[model samples]
Target chain A: MPRETSRDNMLREKHGKEIDDIISRYPVRRSALLPLLYLAQREQGYVTEAAMKEIAQILKLTPPQVYETITFYTMLNLKPVGKFHIQVCKSLMCALVGSDQLVGWFHAKLGIKPGETTPDKLFTLSVVECLGACGTGPMMQINDDYYERLTEQKVDQILSDLKKTGACPLKSGPFMWPEARSAK
Target chain B: MPKHELILLKNMMTPGYTGSLKDYEKTGGYQALKKVVGKVQPADVTQLVMKSGLRGRGGAGFPTGVKWNFLPKDYKGPKYLCCNADESEPGTFKDRQLMERDPHQVLEGIAIAAYAIGAESSYIYIRGEFVLGAHILDKAVAEAQQAGYLGKNVLGSGANIQIYVHRGAGAYICGEETALLESLEGKRGLPRVKPPFPATSGLYGKPTVVNNVETLANLPHIVNRGPEWFAAIGSAPKSTGTRIFCVSGHVKNPGNYEVPMGITLRELIFEHAGGMRSDKKLKAIIPGGASAPFLTEQHLDVKLDFESVAQAGSMLGSGGVTVMEEGTSMVWAALRLMEFFFHESCGKCSPCREGSSWLTQTVRRILAKRGRMEDIETLKQLCQNIAGRTICAFGDAEVAPIMSTLQYWRHEYEELIREAEAHREKELPMAAARH
Candidate 1:
């Protein structure tokens, strides 16, 4: 975790302006907690306790108030997720389309199940609810972008490409490449 | 496939809707605003809505009139009326359908609601991801403004209602009314603690009414068709009107189905959704999105209404019905939902933040063929702690999947654990020592 001093500075420098902008939009200050956290998280990869404390201070809220806001929604990650945080959609629509096998494959390749960061810190895998892209199920989101219609072979190729490209890989939503074989 | 039923509810969803003022005017849109403006007092409108028993279509089933009534008539500050278009709930896409197909309907609904609530300005808080839908709504609002339906002196009645379409930054929690208001204020989408409720203290600390897209869509019809007509359609005595259920998964026909409130699950799936897709028989149904309690084949005949579903130990949440065929494992399905709640958990409370993680881990342990008999009981205990303890229903939403799955499919979980134990014994032989 980043130290409190640096986190505080980041919140003051980046999140402070964003928090002001968000709070100004709302007639209420308490509602600014979510966006402030988002801005805080973007400034720092994950929300440290220090950053959360500062957020509470900035919003004229208690630490619990900030904690309650963070705990209510799922998009904000408090702990450090890997450089490429792989979020697989394991909800009903995606499950029917074979999200399980893909998840298992990720477990094998990454050596970490959902919620575990890889030893090398290259990836952190977690399962999410329906990403609202049910039409393209068996999908995974890496960072901000989405990758749909996954297969083991495709997973292998995608991993290889991610390994090759230090930067986040481009999204390839199912239609781009056919799976090696039809398990069906 | 409902074959796109164009009932009185979907009057504004005509194809090739350009959202132009002339187009909406030609279609007899905004006439209700013209009809209700001078003729209807805000209290009379509120009474009409109260009599109709129009509960919020958003997750909470609070009565719409009651919500509007909560706004302090004595307060002289600026109040807001927010249209919650952040349709991020899993399996729930009814709002998206309403917005995409019928933008003007929603706008008209907003106008009626603003008039009823005594609000001068309203904001349609749309989700960021809904680019197309937002565009349609934005254009519709602009058209309503041009047609003297949204701006100052709407329909020449001197009741000025200015509607602004505020786009959200793609957060699911914003679907919650207060969170939607917060996001509309250009903040991150996080839910607020209730009690003061939006009607009393919402949007900018004024008395705001944050209604869902579907709930607001019903406003114009309630004003135009009369509340009595709406009350007569649905199943419950207090709850009125048709509900749009977005049926998906393992079904032959999966789409948005709008039916009278008292319709049965059997009718919805077999008659409306065209039954299960494969030869695989129905295993279970998550009747009301991921948050609601799961129902087995036994509850298929249960009436799909808020009260009936609640009586049966589940809610008619967002009316997103997901079907699971026999080929699917109930254990996996439950785990999948748990995983969603785990990842989606904003991680504020120890019970929910930690409990969801624990549930997902336990489910994974069970699925990975590394199961313990004690883990099942621990899972139940964890769920017990998580439920009703958090700031939002999210904690309770997390519990439904865990408890419902265990209640309906305990045998399946036992089988998975036993299967895993056997596999561990055969493969590792000394795997027990590792633990």
Candidate 2:
């Protein structure tokens, strides 16, 4: 039998109550797989093998079942990503509005290709599909926030701000929460 | 219509309408739920929707009332209402606006649908990329539960309804009803074959009614204003009610415009969307989301309704209008759209999976100046093979861009091949000199 590592034990010990709460939302425990995977990704930087096994055990699913779901979803990362993952929208609408140029700019500035993490591990560059923010084109999502209507100058400013302060200073569009409610 | 009477998007444009349950209540949000529970029969709500001529806004144009009526009448099992908040269609973003700006509106719609369909539990399967929208909905569901609108014995009618938000992990196929059921069941988002559709057996082998976010958002107004008022809004009889047209790409003011059905594409682009950007000459237009065929400048006068657009060799799919200027390359556009399809094929069926890859490769070769003259016909033949073979509409959708572009711009492909041959001939001399 395979032994349990301390990391696995720690993850379960930390997220036990929250995992139970999420599982309780659905009639079947297997239905909670996606949300539990999301929770694991949130707790760790990305979904690790240990995290998948732990999630499977909690949801009464085999680890292979959990792993298959993890592989299917684009949002769930298997390997570790940087603290701030910058995903640029490269779909039809965004592509029409110079998302290719935006991707080029990120490559030049970050010195990393689309699916690569920087050496410092501060940022990872990725090109994703339509984030449903097509109205505001040339958009990029850094962590949980989106920075839309991008220009070279805006990209430079955003990168510099991120480098200096470890945070994105720019705001998302009017459709986002908190700011959306207050906007006219 | 003077200002396009807005039903679903009424609170969206209002100032200080912060999507709060309180603000939504002020605008008469949950009144429909209050009236439906213990007051109106479940079948009557379906009848009202049928009278309203409400159709699915999620590209299918399926009659909403007809779909709700498909559920077995005295089924003893637990029924479910799954709201398709997974708006990942390439150019469609209207549902995101509705959910982000007026979350309670959608929640109230879900509540009413749950009551009307005799569903004890409902799930809003939202896209994973909609982080803020999901958060807003989470808060809205909690607020509704707290206010005695969503939880057990909802409004003291003895009808229990609980709404939960399920986030999808960035797959476009999940927007399809059965694929959505599969994803909700914690499997890959592979679309299932019909005949045992979601209305009969869905969400763990029970009767289900999967609805678009915009489709459900119209419920409150339909119940309050009566079906006749809703049916009278649109110009067309079959496609009734206002549709939120998300106009993006090359328009001066690219945003969501909630206009009445059957509005002219010319009016939607020139008047409402502030015309084309930079005063450039228009070349092509994608009247719907990426799945719909591309229409040329001649189609500017086409009506932006399902039937009219269908007559014009396209669909009013999700009402996503994408405009392209004169400088845009038709080959490049086709290639880019093919790239999207190739990436999102889901690989459930061989035709969609392998055909999309080959089509993408052919288009990329053309773009890279390495394509043969016969490749254009090859692409068309491949599209013909793929469209009607797959289990879902995705197979048909994957061919729209290639087929439509080839129909309108065959000369463009010929010109590209000639240019490539000329460049290659010129390079042959340089190769000789180097040798």
lDDT top scorer:
2
Where's the lowest-lDDT run of ten residues in candidate 2 chain B?
B426-435
Over A24-93, each residue of candidate 1 has an lDDT whose tens digit, in order, gives: 6555566566667766667657888888888788878888777755655566776787877788877777
Tens digit per residue, CA lDDT, model 1, B1-435: 234333433443344555456665677777777788868888898899998889989878889998888888877778789888777778876776677666787888899999888888787777654556666777777777777778888877888798866656546667777767666553445668887788787877678888888998888777777888788878758667888787878887666667888789999899877788878888888888889989989999889889888888888988888888886777788887887787767655788889999999898888776887888999999999999898878889988988998998898789878887766646654765465
lDDT digits (tens) for residues B1-435 of candidate 2: 236566776776676778898999999889988888889999999999999999998989899999999999989889999999999898898888889889999998888888889999999999988888888899999999999998999899999999999999989889989999999999898999887988999999899999999999999999998999998887659889999888889888788888899889999899887788987898999998999999999999998888999999999989889999988999999988898899998999999999999999988878777667889889999999999999999999999999999999988888887777777755665553332
Which candidate number would show the highest TM-score if scored against the true structure?
2
CA lDDT of every candidate = 0.75, 0.87
Candidate 1 segments exceeding 4 Å error: A1-89, A99-128, A133-184, B1-5, B12-21, B184-190, B423-435
DockQ values, each candidate:
0.14, 0.49
Deviation (Å) of B374 in candidate 1: 1.2
Q: Which docking class does model 2 fall in?
A: acceptable
**Residue pairs with backbone atoms closer than 3 Å in model 1 (clashes):** A27-B204, A35-B188, A70-B346, A71-B346, A71-B347, A71-B348, A73-B346, A74-B344, B235-B262
